[model samples]
Target: MTAVQGFVRQIDLPQIHDPRGDLTFVEGGKHIPFEIRRVYYLYNVPVDAERGGHAHRELEQVVFALSGSFRIKIDDGREKSEYWLRDPRKGLYINRLVWREMDSFSQGAVCMVLASHRYDEGDYYRNYDDFLAAIRVAAE
Candidate 1:
């Protein structure tokens, strides 16, 4: 996997193959860089629907496509990168202070997000301009 923005990278989870079915598991601080505190999944999304348009102040996340696929665009103040997630055993780890936008979801796509912190509206920089401004201040 390639690195992105010096903070984002692809994390490969441990997969067990069996005659019954394949199994994958994630252990916080082991499979990912941060401890997981919250878990959420998005499904039944329209093919043209878009999600995520913000950056977190202190929250880090690892997103996995449990089923189907989607595209995620990430930017770190300076550089931007995109990833197409389809495999259930791989995830995109995004650190705090990075902006992310998700779209181009395939039909029946399922996006699962493992967050390092609980949901906090105050922790979100929903506006791109404001996120960039915060990035500048953090860089100073």
Candidate 2:
């Protein structure tokens, strides 16, 4: 096993602006670093409410704030950091074994997540304490 480090990767997306709104584009293995196997979005969220209280064992994800702004909290057990996602054309590339929580959403905030794997219960560590312990053990 290898040690985990928390980091954010930003991707520049192709955008087109019109009278209505701006359009951002993404294509698997092109604009996005990995082929997207699953797609999900979170909306109608309350302010200061946290979500995604889990870490994936092997899955890779790219998170984008499509509509509004939010804060992303990332932890590698040994260290933790927080990032604000406000740009629709940019995304945060989250690697494996890093715990993440999304919170501080503005009104009508839409968060889109592009995943590299299908849904699997076994791949997720839902408990924060368990995630910390696992990271500590992996670091030793």
Candidate 3:
């Protein structure tokens, strides 16, 4: 129930446990709040590597750590929070307009992202200052 203005939160997907191994599955618009249009993953990242220092205008995403772990810092202009993604069945859902910074990746960490839209450079606010200014303009 920890939600940042209903724009950021952790979602747990359904998991089936067995003696052999555990199984997890996600369905578009069922497990997540949006229909997944794009799926991508990051791997072989250095332990000191950093990723995702930007915000989206109209796109939302759910990021997961499939192999190891990583930390995500979220900012909504008014508040900031951090989350550690280490579980395969859990993901951090980031709504549109929320700034995000991810780092502190463990060795051999694999990050999977389920996006609501495909890659669009126009939808991204890659600069933190620009993103903050936009947030302020929208608030006023």
Candidate 4:
């Protein structure tokens, strides 16, 4: 557990190479700590465009770069870290109570996310200040 950033770390997915092509897969509860309840992808983003400027109250996720590359900045109210995602066979795990921002996308960057929960607006802290407050409440 990376306390400061709520970043569990990078997890390598199962990969299989074949003569025709290659394949990589992730299994919920088998490879990841949570069962996947949602799946989403981001694509066609401008290089300088930023995404994800909030924190989750009780959500977990794994981010993957299905194509191209990008950078994600994570902050858990105290510390910050930057990660690059360029491998399709790897995923970055993010725990709850963490703030994240995604930017610096390369050309044709395609970001895929596997989430532990379905959409719930109340579970999100859309503002940094709110997130900090929630973090403090959680600590107590």
Can you give the TM-score per candidate against the true fold?
0.94, 0.86, 0.93, 0.93
Q: Per-residue lDDT of 25-109 in model 2, one digit per residue for the tens?
A: 8997787667899999999999978899899888888899988999999887767898899999989888788899999999999
**Number of the top-ranking candidate, with TM-score as the measure:** 1
Off by over 4 Å in 2: 1-7, 17-21
Query: Model 3: which residue pairs collide?
Result: none
Candidate 3 per-residue lDDT over residues 31-50, each given as its tens digit: 89889999999999888888
Stretches of candidate 1 exceeding 4 Å from the true structure: 1-6
Q: Which stretches of candidate 4 lie over 4 Å from their true place?
A: 1-5
Tell me model 4's lDDT, rounded to 2 decimals. 0.89
The TM-score obtained by model 1 is: 0.94
lDDT of each: 0.90, 0.86, 0.90, 0.89
Specify the highest-lDDT model's number: 1
lDDT of 4 by residue, 37-128 (tens): 99999999999899999889889999999999999999988899999999999999999988999999999999999998999999999989
